[model samples]
Target: MTNQQFKSTLQALSLPANRSAIVGIKRGIERETLRITEQGRLSAKQHAAALGSPLTHPSITTDFSEALLEFITPAQSDAELTIKQLEDIHKFTLAHIGDEILWPISMPCFIKHQDEIALAQYGTSNTAQMKTLYREGLKNRYGSMMQAIAGVHFNISLPESFWQTLQTIRQNTQPKQAFISDSYLGVIRNFKRNLWLISYLFGASPALCSSFLQGRDTKLPFEAFGKGSLYLPYGTALRLGDLGYTNSAQSALNVTYNNLDQYISGLKSAITTESDLYRNIGTYPDGRLKQLNHNILQIENEFYSPIRPKRNTAPGEKPTEALARGGIEYIEVRALDVNPFSPVGISLEQVYFLDVFITYCALMPSPDMSTQQQQETQENLSAVVNAGRDPELCLVQDGQSISLKQWGQTLFTDLRAVARYLDDAHNETHYVAVIESLQKAIADPEQTYSGQYMQQVLNSGLDNGHFVFELAKQYKANFAASDYSVYSEAEFEQMAQESDQQRLQIEQSDTLDFNAFLADYFKA
Candidate 1:
């Protein structure tokens, strides 16, 4: 905790009748994208019924495929008004995407095949056929082109009067959802022990498009380009490394965070265990169901974590029954990576340096990480997502070996005193000039955004698929020549006709049938 004990507990919670102690820094983002085409492949289109109803859109959706998409932005406490509401949801989804584009990296550059992608479609409802049967059980357990890899989540939260001013600066008398679910699991164990300093300061996918290794079998070396790209001259976010969403049955489910009932009893025993490799990938084969559960998690958001502990679930609960009925209400960072030099892929100084590094991972001092400090936080997040700007890199903190620029100059000198206590609780130096521009991307990893997008694809000799397909056609012509400053094209066409009449009133008020709604959603 010491950065002078979090600046004397933010000067005794900035007393002026605790002026709502820096006004509840909420936030929210989500992001994701893909919908390719003008020669950059992917797009087997379909999600555009004039951009809405990706299951009753509150802010457009579609994630595991049907040309990806996923924009969301509601919660806001001005991180430049949540990036001007994600640039007005990418200018109302590029004014209903007529000539596709969006895909500006987090890997997956171009693909001519992988059964030409597809998945996401939500029509008949038993909750939109269990959200496309959980992306057909993630394409029968990871494939449909590694679920078209995309990124950025963010979410964050901190208000119940800033956790009652950190439970009155720790003179604790618990229970307000158990001290905000154990202070959001001590900010997800100091954001998994300093989330590889946010994947070495916003690790942008350092290179790919060798059809995202569609013929797997790496041993590192990489290097090629133009006729099937592939890189690693010190890569940074090979989409959160091990070539994205690494899995061996969730690395044998050794999930634990030390609290929140041992992290919802290891996600309800990986959603009621069972799995001979997802029971030979068959929840229903010939008669086609293909994945609501042969288990090793056909739920609990399939346990992939770069930070989670969220809550907001209700109408028919389940996100572990809203954290076993109200506990950790928000955290969801999900290791970022989708800046692609921001044209709305996120920026406003990377959303005010991730609100000053998630408020210095909720005022530091977090401990409980064991299991060999969670395998030295996955080997310091795979050494900053595979060779973080390699000039003799090194990481793994609490178990020694430092120098990733001296642990990013000791976490930007404690994130410049948490960006000067959030610019003295919002009188605002804009989070101390976003910690002096992230301490110059920790003393120059070529001023980050994955080292200036690998020096703009090595000074534009083009080939990370025509340099992200000519910068995704100049960020879809600068989000179609921008204009919807915070919504209204007749309110996004009346929210695309009320998300297509609330998805036809939840498919005419259904009455259990997709196998009795997956047996009352896994009866628990």
Candidate 2:
């Protein structure tokens, strides 16, 4: 699909009968943040019992560390509602966790040692043990310091009506689910190719406490700030870089996204393959079962990507199994750093812009990404991570080198067009307005979140710890002072109780020993 062809399709979608199909476009968010003390340290606490079980809770759960809270909102057609739900979760959480404040940024707070970060615990059911064991494997493979880095995942799915309209527009004869899966794969490919823009616009992890480096030497040309602070002068999102929540060992695995089967098969191969490095780590270190096995990947979730095709799984279903069973239900965008400026780590304008960008990705024609092409995309991302604000920086596309400004202009033009169609469909002006506002980010790199936030850090002369510590206090107070808008405190308290009961039921219902349960899970 060339630009002209995409325009024609947009024309078709703009028809009155088809445009209304977009009303059902669903989006959800999964935001992760570390629980920290008021003194700017990782909280030395378990997951708050008042918050609910980490296993059965639908809205709140712990991610890698017990102190790391993951807030989930149900998929909603309106982005505004999603933000509201996220805000309500924060309000509820802050009220429950006593004096502890949520880390308001992607990079973690000060840590003295890796042992201070405990693996997220989920009771004693076999399923719960499996979840904890997976974290243990992650700790053994990569240090826990990296896993403490936080991020936001935006999960989106086009409406059934929109897909039906497109299928009819193109006369696609494949089965409905198959067509949806194929189209979503195209979105994944395009998203990967254009992911650098996201890093430039929203990436905000430019600095961190020196402790995150774990006292190791770094190749990055980092400058020192007050006492323990370190930063790159032009860096955008260090969280997405090699130093934060990324898996370097999986770089050797060629995980392709050509089709559902190919993607799933590749992940399966990854988990099944043995690794001598991990084997040397000792799966049973001191006969205590440190990791699941000496495999290259303990499970499919360990294979990190900026974007992923997702489907709601049945009980005991693997992610790939869900995709294979019902095709792609949605795409989880893992590229975004937690927006430091927003109370909920995301904003309404940002969500509006995402709808435009995601729509453009789905509409664009995407060729199968060659291994070299994929490598170039990652190179572009790494470049942006370290020094995206440099005017001299260039990124390669289709074997041609281009300045970031020129490439960004091209993307915004297409994005603006998509935003207009979204306006026509959703009966709102926010989409195009968001495009126009964010378009300035391309013309002036300083308008980006990381660009602006880094200036504040430099000007304050306070250490990274005190700067973010001050900001976090404001967010904590805001959550505390504001009354719940979506769900009441009593309701949230009841839900926590319900979640605890559910976890207890699952524990009571366990029929097999942990060993037999693990064996049965692998068999599936």
Candidate 3:
């Protein structure tokens, strides 16, 4: 695909009957907080009984640590509606969590000790045991503190009709699933090339508690604020930088998104490839399973990319198996931080802007990325995460240097066109309005969430940790006081009861021993 071909395809797809692209967006938010106490220490309490079983809840679950709450929203075509539903989930969850406040920031600020962070416990079922064992492996590899860092994942998928429209434009002769998957891979390549812009614009974890570093060596020159908070004046998102959740082992895999088969093969091989470091730990230690295997990955989900090709797996089906069985059902964007300004962690404007950006990626001419380009992408992401707010920052693109602002403006110009198309298709001006507001952020870095948050903390005369903790309390109060607009109280109660029952049934129905089950799962 070329720029000219992209323009012609956009023109063809803009026909009145084909104008609307049915898009579905899903969100999974993972938040971690110190227990609601006068001292703000990590909580030792289990998942609240009132919030339902973490093992079986449809919309709520635990992630990494027992204190880390993850809320999930079903797919919706309307960004506003999707956010509204997420808000409702927050409202209902807050009402149930007793005194706990949802953490307002991505980096955990108040953790006192690694021993204080408990691995999430899903009950006695074989499957549940596997989940905990995998976490144990992560704990051994990355430490629980790093695993406790929170973020949001945005999953989006274009409908069959949207792909059919593209197929007609391209005269694609392959099977529909193959074409859709290949098209998604192309978009993913472009996403990798341009993700630095997203980190620069939306990254919010610029500062963190000095305690978070735990004496690790770093080149980052830090200034101290109230109560030992460490900050870099021009830093963007340290959470996505070297300080964040990363695996050196996966970096060596060099997974490429050039095609679906290659992507799946890379993932499968990583899952099967044994690691010397992990092998030393062994699969069974002290007569209990330490991990699923000594492989580089416990599962495909552990590959830890900024984005993933997703297909909702069937019962007992592995993620790689699902993609190999059926082409990608969606792509999950994993680079977003937990925006401290929004009660639900993301705003409607952010959602709408992502729609425009992802659509542009789909339509753009994305040449396949080579291994060298992959390394360059990582470098660009690092540059943005560390010093994106610096006016003179430059990013590598196609082996050439470009100013971050120049590339951002260029991308935004194309995004405006996308917004126009979306607005026309939906018979509304909302998408255009989103682009206009984001345009201001591009022109002025101070308008970005990261920039605004830094300024807010500085003006408040509080450490970053204390500032976010105050915001967390405020959000907790607001959500607790709000009425559930999307779900009734009865509905929430019913769902909780059902989830608990499902967990019980799963526990009672397990037929295989834990060791045998792990063996069979890996074999499958």
Candidate 4:
């Protein structure tokens, strides 16, 4: 789309129209940092201060030292940092507690195709091939669920039992894998560890859960952990399918109360059946999918609590780690819809827009306010998601209400300024297209993938098979056209083949001992 066309599209979305909200960080100023260092991993002085003897649950009595909370006074002069700017700190943290964060089981398995339609279009039918395909599909699907959870989980209450699990492990010996080199379980371990770190790092409050968990009382309520996106499991997906996107999960308490255990038990189910329902496309009959759906529903029902470090004065189990950190340097944009059309899964333009948005968020002062303000912010977010294309949707900023199109336009104007600054500092012109696309999305929401999804669904009557087929076609076409250096179509196909062979080997192995594998898994 042309710049003029994009601009015109923005005008109708009711977003801010000017450049005041935009703040750009100079390029070469260290956008993001990643390091796994032991040297600067929480200074001895800081750790000593931060780790004052652990607090008792529900009533934290600190020695009034800096050790209890990783507090940052507003006036303290830490240099302003962008989300990307924290890469080094993140890396260091990862290295310090790396193995704790990886969760291999969370990794999606591939589903190979056997027939020509499945093989030619979707790749091979071997276990590895199917697993690879499953992973891609799982990433996109899981990504969507996580995005949803991110928006609302912050308000959910974390349960004490879950928090205790991590704390128990942490106070004990450090897992050998946590400090090992070349750890294959990096991602999952990192995520799990970080979940534990929050209480120590942020002093997260259990009070946050009271409002959402009041009447239902299904043990600990859902918190910001998996509630947003990671909540997928079999039963939950079924519930989501039953409940449209607009309604909150809290509405369906009765159905959940009836079969809670079945739903929870199903979390580990594997989708073993291979009916034609999931033949060529990425869909599968794996019981695991059902379990994932169930998990999401269970979360929606507020059964699962996010594990957090311990806090005193709260009537819950303490997390192994006594404290957690909060205070956002940058909000992780967990909601990227896999552009089934893009080969690398996302475009340079998307990345640029993300960079621009995070910078904008960093520069803007928090819009903190009374309950009313929080409500307004929630409404604005909902509008952006549900009524993004309504043209008349309005958002509030600085005490005044503006149409979303106007707001978007104003935001992008600031974004453009940031992009210009970025270009000058980094000598990078890659962000220009992304800035242009944002401009277009604001002016005409229809240009967005969300809008496109709506259009296709409406045109095709929401047929799942057709929806997935078209998605595959879009992705394949994008793969053929783009020149992303990392993952080529040929490489992807080869990976699928190898994955299939591996699965077959495991299935046909002579000394297969499922019970032994289970024993080892739980023992660790």
TM-score of each: 0.33, 0.98, 0.96, 0.36
Residue-level error in angstroms, candidate 4, position 408: 1.1
Tens-digit per-residue lDDT, 68-138, candidate 2: 99999999887778898899999999988989999989999899999999999999998899999999989
* Candidate 1 TM-score versus the reference: 0.33
Q: Put down candidate 4 lDDT per residue, 1-524, tens digits, no spaces.
A: 33343343223211232222222322111111111112211111222211121121111111111111111111111112222222222222222332221100111111111110111011222322223333344333322221121111111111222223322423435443221111111211222222211211111111111222223234222223211111111011111121112234323222211122322233212122222322333334562232122222211212222211112222221121112121111112222333323322233355455454543332232222343543454445434433345567666654688886775666667668656644544456756656875577657655665555434444665332234345444433443344433333354345434544543554565242443432342233
lDDT of candidate 3 over 436-522, digit per residue (tens): 888887778888888999999999999877888788888878877787778887887888999999999999999999889888888
> lDDT of each prediction vs. the true structure?
0.80, 0.90, 0.82, 0.29
Q: What TM-score does candidate 3 get on C-alpha atoms?
A: 0.96
Q: Best by lDDT, which number? A: 2
Question: What lDDT score goes with residue 216 in model 3?
Answer: 74
Q: Pick by TM-score: which candidate is best?
A: 2
Quote the positional error of residue 343 for candidate 4 in Å: 3.6
Better of 2 and 4 by lDDT: 2
- Candidate 1 per-residue C-alpha lDDT over 409-486 given as tens digits, one digit per residue, 9 for 90 to 100: 877887887687677777778788767777887777878778888787878887778887888889788777877777
Q: Each model's number of backbone clashes?
A: 1, 0, 0, 106
What does the lDDT come to for candidate 2?
0.90
The weakest ten consecutive residues by lDDT in model 3 span: 24-33
